[model samples]
Target: MVKTPLFKSLPSRDRTAAKKLVAPAVIGIWIVILFPLLYALYVSFHDWILSQGKIGEVNFSNYITVLKDPLLLNAAKNTILLTVSVVVLEIAIGFGLALLLNNKRIRLRNLYLFILLVPMLMPPITVGLIWRLLLHPDLGIINYMLSLVGLPQPIWLADPVLAMITIIIVDVWHETSFIILVLLAGLTSLPDEMYEAAMIDGASAWQKFKFVTLPLMAPTILVATIIRMIAALKTYDLVYILTRGGPGISTETISYYIYKVFFVFLDMGKSSAMAFILLAIIILMTLILMRVMRTAEQ
Candidate 1:
């Protein structure tokens, strides 16, 4: 028999094969994600006005301009309002609905869940377009119905205040399903023995949920909230398709403003800077949430 090696060479060969298998994905990520990010960061430091041919001029003046812009400030404020409102409403409404659906006694629960999830399944653009048609001030079925009922048919996306509220409602409608699905899965995965013990202890329905369920489910809720908040901070497509930051910019978000700066205003440098700023904000939120999650887990 041949002398056996102390460490197998096959393991090294396997590692090589595994690296070969993962190489494409790594390369693709570099090309698709890392390269663009690096290029964008480089661009942020230079003035690159497409229209005026002011390319490759290094400066941080645009970043200062962006920081001081009142419109950007307004967009930031609007984003905060929209993010907070939608997250709160969606979490409250979604968790409530999840609790209802999680109950075995609810009739046609599957059907209801399917219907409720329809909006979320639709693309954001499609949702925006559908709601636009439905909420059209003059020609929409909603306004027509309101007229029949002798009520004021407000312009959903035209009025400044209403535009913001409409965006929030539309966002809630589209996003609540996600919250419900996450929370419902969390509810389902919880151990039944704990609840059985609680029942043995003479805990009421509300008491069981408050004392046992909430503590166990807190982490899941925090995770879902963080994911939603990150997405919320990056809101652009809905605002784009729905309002285009119009009706006097009441619904303008930082993402939308950055788009306008890059594409509409032809200011690539400032847009890149704004994008990084937004990234920093997102990273901050993520870091804070991650810390909270770790603490909660412990």
Candidate 2:
């Protein structure tokens, strides 16, 4: 039976109307999200007071001053350190856990997954406060346990290096579950025929994993890592609550530094400039990830 012209063409008008209705929603979304970002960029180039009438002129002075500021540079460096350390550790542990849990023998898999996801679901401020209590030199559980073992407890928060280390540890703890869940999904969805073929070809377990598993799982791993990096780089709540960017700027990551500039110092211009710099860095990294992974997939 041949379809009538009315039947074929009736949907076109509906789709056009739907697109027209969606246009305003799309524009509103752009306005809400992109407007603030573009405004922040504009503020970064002008020396604008938070309470001023208008930002008179735009210049690169804010960027220049921020770049020349040693404290800002140190904060950027520390932020990079925090992001890299957390991502590396989380990926390793997350993948390891995923591989282990992927086994058929693990009982209560759903329960384990639920427990692991608790940290990621918790509020950042709560995690910070909880870790602060745990890392407390005098009354914390960690120190108390160490004392029971007849060891002298070190000041975890007071010491700069220890403080940074603690932040990284907490970050890894919180985010590894996300990686685990994504990887577990990827692992379970994998075609078993590849592994079976490898076994038929007399390939060892390690070789099958190294060649077949890794390549297929690369896309999932890349997505997880990118997400984790983005979250880690923007980490502010944990550092803020735990150290307050204290111990003499030792654990001062970029987000916390921006908070300090905007709130503590009331330097919106400098803060905006620093924010734009961070935005540029993240955007570049995302683009690079896309290119490398696209090529790899091909």
Candidate 3:
């Protein structure tokens, strides 16, 4: 039995050179990504940075304090509300839009897609500013339109309930395009024969959709949900721009709360703890989503 010439010709020096070339790049990436996470973890267990600055002592007091803080609890509630509401709305709207556009009969599909995706592609700051202007009570376009229609103008950002609604609207508007793109990909990838067979069997539109479209698109939908959930959970830029976590903290999410703790309040220890806690929640949710998706796939 003769070994391959390629294997026989391979030299120890080549392997040594390849290792030396790759090692530094791998270490550089680890330092860039892992180092901040490690430092944040270390800081999360410390007491407030005292007069000694970097010489401060370490403890679990910060985590304990945050766990007991009423503000943190409220922030947690608001975060969950914002994430779930926006994600659900985005998925529904996105699915509807994807289904509509998937039909070849729809005229100017490219134009429709472009229009739908513009909001998602806009800069977060720009989106926030545009929404702020539109939602403004006194001199905004929305109010003006309402007045023209003999309706009372609603204070979109000033009331707590309205503020939450405004946040969800903005999130859904920006994120629905992503869902549409993902689902549309799935729709286009499906085998048309299944739908043809369903049609031949005299299946109703609803029945075909329920029995054929959904099962085939389940994996794509799961992936899109995960992506949207992660983005919604970490939503910060639009919230910061539109509300600044304002209207009496009604829109204050965990990310915004963490920002306030670290930057506005200058409490690094507790902020680090909160950040780690949020990280843990995100990890758990991602794992759950992955497991459910795998089950569905099988």
TM-score winner: 1
- Candidate 3, residue 205: how far the Cα is off, in Å: 1.8
Give lDDT tens digits, candidate 2, residues 109-130.
Answer: 7788788878988888898899
Candidate 3, 1-298: lDDT as tens digits? 8975666565889888879999998899889978888988888888665344662577867788888988888888998899889888988999999999999999999899889987777887888898889878887899999999999898888888888889888888777888998899899999999999999999999999999999999889999999888878888898799888888888898999999988887777888999988988899989999999999999
User: Positional deviation of 244 in candidate 1, in angstroms?
Assistant: 0.6
- What TM-score fits each model? 0.93, 0.91, 0.91
RMSD of each: 4.5, 3.9, 3.9
Error of 2 at 14 (Å): 3.7
Q: Residue 220 of candidate 3: its Cα lDDT?
A: 90
Q: What is the lDDT of residue 11 in candidate 3?
A: 89
| 93: Cα error in model 2, Å | 0.2
Residue 55's lDDT within candidate 3 is 29
Question: For model 3, what is the alpha-carbon lDDT of residue 159?
Answer: 83
lDDT-better candidate, 1 vs 2:
1
RMSD of 2: 3.9
Cα lDDT, all candidates: 0.91, 0.88, 0.87
Model number with the top lDDT: 1
Better of 1 and 3 by lDDT: 1
